[model samples]
Target: MKALIRSSAAVSAFILALSSSGVLIAQAATTGTTTTPTPMTSTATSDLTAGPLTLTAVPSFDFGTATLTGTTGDKVPGSSVTGALKVTNPGQIGGWQVTVAGTPFTDTSGTALTGTILSLDGLATNPITADDSTNTSTLPTFVTPETISTSATVVESAAPSTSTSHIGIGSYTTSYDAAASSLAVPSSTVAGTYTSTLTWTMSNAPA
Candidate 1:
């Protein structure tokens, strides 16, 4: 009986030792456990700028040579010329204007041609054309020379974003049709080459 009891005690001691070993192994596994994570981010931006108002002169007027045949006090043979002006208004909210001034026709000897008249026709923001007196649709005439001349509303742009008729921010062109007439060539009129100068000015202010 005593030997049987001793054998039962030894079995119980072995079972308890096995349970302790399992618990120690579980604690060792948990001690080295760890985790980590990283965060990310980003950013963005934008900017807008306005452009400047500017003007550019295009081709000049060239009145080809002509021979005078009319009697004194009568209009003589003359020529007509064509030219243009270009304007750029980037982001402009208002309208603009263009003016033209011409010097008197003079010879190299500084002799001014008297009784001469210059006429401007087909003054428009688009392609310019000479005015036909017979056609009332043509532009007005500028008889007085050497003066700052303004045409009808060349560019009627609408207020910015207020109306669909406003001129946009971009380049615009204006063409001019011009004609010149010489007053009667005096019987004593000299035979020589003549020349003149035309100056163009532009402004944001309405004319």
Candidate 2:
């Protein structure tokens, strides 16, 4: 009877395997490939033109109104803006100078003022930077208490360039000091509005 039971159990296992569909299969996983980075480049530029050495700006002087003092010479101190003479250098030059002169002060009816003096007092020298910069070197000498001339007079001057440092290679400005400007009028001066033109001349002359 025990042999008969064991045979029945083996037949049942065989029938279960036969009733199934198909076999289960397992597939392996995989990875992908990669590459390194790359590099690139570009460019840029600018341009400059040569500028001429020249006097750029001239200042205007205004001496305030005064009463006629027919007894003696009259001195009037005046206040002014743009009281500096500005110059620019184009480089490749030795040095330079500035000369000053004035025309006769004339009234509306063409009457002229003779023996009138325009005194530009002590002017402070300025050192240049950038195109013309200041350094530990000898600077230009400026005429002080300058009694303006009918003819041209050297108001400011500089020595010739002995080397690169000596060359006048930048912009320059000589400014007026405090209460440094005045107009001197002779006795019996006309009591009317008068206008005068101050001629400022700049040159490449190295003195």
* Candidate 2, pairs of clashing residues: 128-133, 128-134, 129-133, 132-170
Q: What is the C-alpha lDDT of each candidate?
A: 0.51, 0.71
The TM-score measured for candidate 2 stands at 0.66
lDDT of 1 at 125: 33
**Candidate 2, which segments miss by more than 4 Å at Cα?**
1-51, 122-138
Give every collision pair in model 1.
Answer: 121-131, 158-166
lDDT of 2 by residue, 1-207 (tens): 999899999898787766542222112222334777887777786565536767877777777777877767798777664646777665434678888899999999999999888887554444222333444345566777688868988877776767546545566666665367888889979799988888999887876
- TM, every model: 0.50, 0.66
Best by lDDT: 2
Best-performing candidate as measured by TM-score: 2
lDDT of 1 by residue, 87-157 (tens): 56655555555566667678999997765544444343334332323322222122222222232223322
